[model samples]
Target: MTSKPEKVRWGILGPGNIAKAFAGGVAHSRTGTLVAVGARNPGKAGLTEAFPGARILDGYEALLGDPDVDAIYISTPHPSHAEWAIKAAEAGKHVLCEKPLGLTAFEADAMIHAARKAGTFLGEAFMYRLHPQTARLVELIRAGAIGEIKMIKSSFGFAMPGFMPEHRLYAKDLAGGGILDVGGYPVSMARLIAGAAAGKPFAEPDEVVGAAHLGQSGVDEWASALLHFPGGIVAEVSCSISLAQDNVLRILGNKGRIEVADFWYAGGQQGGTGEIRIIRPGDTEVVEVKEDGWLYAFEVDAAGEAILGGKQEFAWPGMGWADSLGNLRVLDKWRAAIGLEYDIEKPAKRVNTISGRKLRAGGTAIPKRSIPGLPRPASCLALGFEDFRTFSSGAILLDAYFEAGGNLFDTAFVYGSGYTETLLGQWLKNRGVREQSVVIGKGAHSPLCYPDVIGKQLTQSLERLQTDHIDVYFMHRDNPDVPVDEFVDAMDREVKAGRIRGPFGGSNWTMERMDEAIAYAERTGKQKPGALSNNFSLAEMLEPIWAGCVTSSSDEWKAWLTARQMPNFAWSSQGRGFFTDRAGRDRRDNEELVRVWYSDKNFGRRDRAIELAKRLGKSPIHVALAYVLAQPFPSVPLIGPRSLDELEDSLQALDISLSPDDLAWLDSGSDQARARA
Candidate 1:
């Protein structure tokens, strides 16, 4: 006799209306069992009653932390799916999240990243795709049952008689809309059919044009879209919340058409029969599909089997990471065309009550420079506080900087694993100086360099910085794989929404890439990058200190900046401690300094700087920083200081100014050349 397979114990993240259906499905699934139900409000109407045999947990996090729960089914609202799916993946549980997996492709990418990082399974719960009829339809289409497929038409919608604005169906904060709720069905079906015709698991639409009727609550009520797929295939998909639709799917071909009524129930609704009709010239055929259980049970069983088989996602139904992300990309574009936006996705202006240590208007003021497109003048020196580990520790140096009239703070998402931003937020909130401070938010670092991550990371950064708008946002790294226009459009959306004020640009992008991005923005009538951040110092870099790093102090780069008059925020502006006496010429003693900035050419420049510093009675490091500030174009150098003393030492560099002749001599140590200039 064969041994029975072990059942997968499941946990439900939310106990709501749709979760009840998932509970029913789980109960009927052969390889799945409902072990726990997590309810935010345990006293709610449907917790114990909907899931009788399952343990009632107090919160979603509690359920995820439970050891007995091997898998989690995320049945929360669309906006909450990404967060909890990521949490579940981090907790090492297989995840089955509801459709419209995320509000945007960025969220989907983040969730996918989490799952892949944790080595866990994560599948979107498009239960209808697991139905037998969907499989048969794909098989027949590939077998030429529908010869030369050309078009697909699908829709799903329902009429709510008494639509409440506060209901999840109409609340923008809850990510409620016809497109995110029911429109995913039509879009997914259309993509699946197109993929079938092309002999692939799934295919993304090439072009999408969408229009919507938004309700008073600002949520889409009725939306329609036309998608152009590969091989000249077109699909007309529609969805509605206040109006009823046919709720059917049809694929038209040159030889025949396949029609599916109530396609979302293709596995047989509650143990009933599903029918697909084939119509050709002068002939008609009916195909009946039978099921042994509920329609949703198939997805539950499939998820469990994939987990048992050590698969990250379902194979036959094709609810993998790529499919989920591609579907979200199409939806994101469609929503963009229709102008349907959720308020929850917007950056909120945080208002915190101040308690201690009030800020004064005027003090030891730092020199300010005006960058194009920025409403306010920025301090020429920005403080890099990524290394501060605690609020108390960061607050002292921050207080000293602010009191000294330094306002700009540079922080990135990858900094201190987000602790740096949180500390900055706390300090700003405590001091009530958010309005006066200039926060430079950097995001989309290497390996996470997708265009969608720009918005997602910016949102998180804003929340952590205790402000709605970043004065100057920078992409921390460049991703050559993605087109420059896509990056431009992503930043444009953030700018239009008021999340970023102006002067957004790239941190380490080459001049050519920056020009390409600016041209694309100008051609598309979008905002162009107004600033750049690159390495610039008196001591030249022999190689990149880190991967994908670029320097703006090269002769060619400096000339370009001078001609364009662009602002370049110079990072490592003092040569990463290369100008100090602690760095020696011996490559074996200081390998990092030698590997990065120790070429014969750089050593010669350092010698020139040392001589110039001796003549001017200043530190060589001070001369290095002063050299950066005295450039032909706008140059703001970033300084990372660990304490008040370090900050004061850095501020001393502001006192030393370099003349054009002095800069020329420092570059080549040629006194005759300085005279010629």
Candidate 2:
């Protein structure tokens, strides 16, 4: 006996024009049905008329909370797609968001992460790809109908005669541009065709060169890009909002060429013959393909099947997570080349009004420690600004940290793609405490870890931090391939130029590398590295936390730092929650903690910490932090607190102190009194 197909109930978020097409597609699909339509103004003209059979909801959140809705079709504007898609996933509903998936690749990453965490399906809605004609095109290319594919040319453009500045296509704040809007189509099609040549689902371009014509509204009216993919495949793609183009996709190979006119509209609204033309030396042939339903219906059916199959992403002709990410990454590079930035894309300043409590700078009297070169003292702990997603949410925790005596903010160029720095900068400017705070800026992370990126990223970081100079600058990562002297010289340039005033150092750098850098700086009469940021705590890391990460908690590393009297900014100094009761040998389910910190030796250290905490009337976690602070060399631990309560709990660690004998006993798991003797 055969089982009946599972019925997937769909909800439409932001009942806009595209949403009507999606709802119509779902109505035509066998496995999917539209049950609800949500809009901020549900009573607006044409909304109810468009989705007559579906329940009209008042807001997008209402659709997410609807139990009968199994999945949501997010047709919101580009800027709002990421937020609503994440919320829908968190609410246990699968999502099919409109493209481009988000305003930036960073935003897309966040959406993918949320869906994966929720174990829900997420697919970007590029309706053309799912159409039968696209599949036929891919099959023909893979079959070598066009032998040894070498070049691809695709364009999507239309003329907006009376362009409105506030319209999404022209509004920079809404991430409106030809590149992010229509440009994605040509890019996706090019990548898809290139992937077919390589026998893979998709392939990313190795190089991209883009040019754009920015209109009066500060958004791209027309843009073009040259993309170089692997396997000697090259493509030239273009899109425009104010200029009309052929809107065709042409793939040229050594032996032949194939062209598809009105590629994006094929098998969709036209309701006509879908044609692919092949041109060879002797003859030109036309292949006509027929479609059964709207182009959007294919993606609807595909998403429903994936959800029923318990897959987190859609398969071929459908967008997987990596495919979405790869496409967005290409767009990011293209935008960078053309220098396109959106106001809504920037981090907004948020006011913290938790319980109507106003933020006052100094409330808890946090202890400050002196650094080598800076005249101002930094807080013993640095506030890590990576976890909070929104500026207001982060501001609440930032306010609490400041009230508790935190003047040092830890941020990096890679942190939320500079969103963290933007948030901290807005908070500093809003609080009018830029001079009072110590900003620890970091740059030159992986993939961009070069001599030029060191200076360029630092300049962007400084601008984001809203400060004239960074108090302490750190290379976020190290590349051993580059000469140590070159890295030193790049940093020395910044120091001499007054962009960095207090100290400069390396994070995740080994002791040997640090010595090499410092010695080279000394020999060249340049500024030496004054601090080192690495993992150091009671629980030893079984492996590097991330690529190129280093741990300084080993006995040899500790001895080196002590001998040199070098300041160490210890990250994950509290053992990354290892000292808490939540961690244990039997708790193998917490894979990250278990894989990083679970060991026989670390368990013994935890036991000793518990004993010390009992004697001092403090928590074991607090005692673990105190041990790092009580080290022989200058130690400042970075704290990442997700909430106000967690921040307050971390602050209590400042009051706990450990003597030399106590530290030795904790490390050696021996009696303190005997160790002192």
> Cα RMSD (Å) per model?
16.6, 10.6
Q: TM-score for all predictions?
A: 0.58, 0.66
Kindly provide the TM-score of model 1 when superposed on the true structure, using C-alpha atoms. Answer: 0.58
- For 1-677, candidate 2 gives per-residue lDDT tens digits of 95534788999998878988888888788779889998899888887779968999989879989988999999988877877887888899999999998766666766776788799999999988888898899999999997999999999999887689878899887888799888999999889989999998888999999999999999999999999998889999999999999997899999999999998988556345699999999999999988767777888999999988889898987888888888987988888898887766443422333322356766545688897877698998888979655554466567767887889888999999788998888888877789889998889999788878988898788788888899888898999999999899998999989999988999999888999999898888999999888999977888987888899998999899999888888899998889987798777777778878888988988988887788778899998998898899998899898655467677777788777787877887666543551
Error of 1 at 592 (Å): 34
| Top of the candidates by lDDT | 2
- Cα RMSD, model 1: 16.6
Which tens-of-lDDT digit does each residue in 1-677 have in candidate 1? Answer: 95534998999998887888888999888899998998889787757878989999999889999999999999889877877887888889999998878777766766776787688999998989888878988988998887988999999999998689879998988988899998888998899989989999988999999999988889999999999997899999999999988887889999999998989977465777788899999998998887778988888999989998888888867588788878887888888898876876542311111112245555565777777877877788999987665453466567768878888888999999998899888888777788877888899998999899999999899898878888899999999989999999999999999999978999999999999998998888999989999998888776799999998878999899999898888999998878897676764577778788877777777887787678777888888888898998999999998645567778778888777877887787777745643
User: What is the model-wide C-alpha lDDT for candidate 1?
Assistant: 0.84
TM for candidate 2 is: 0.66
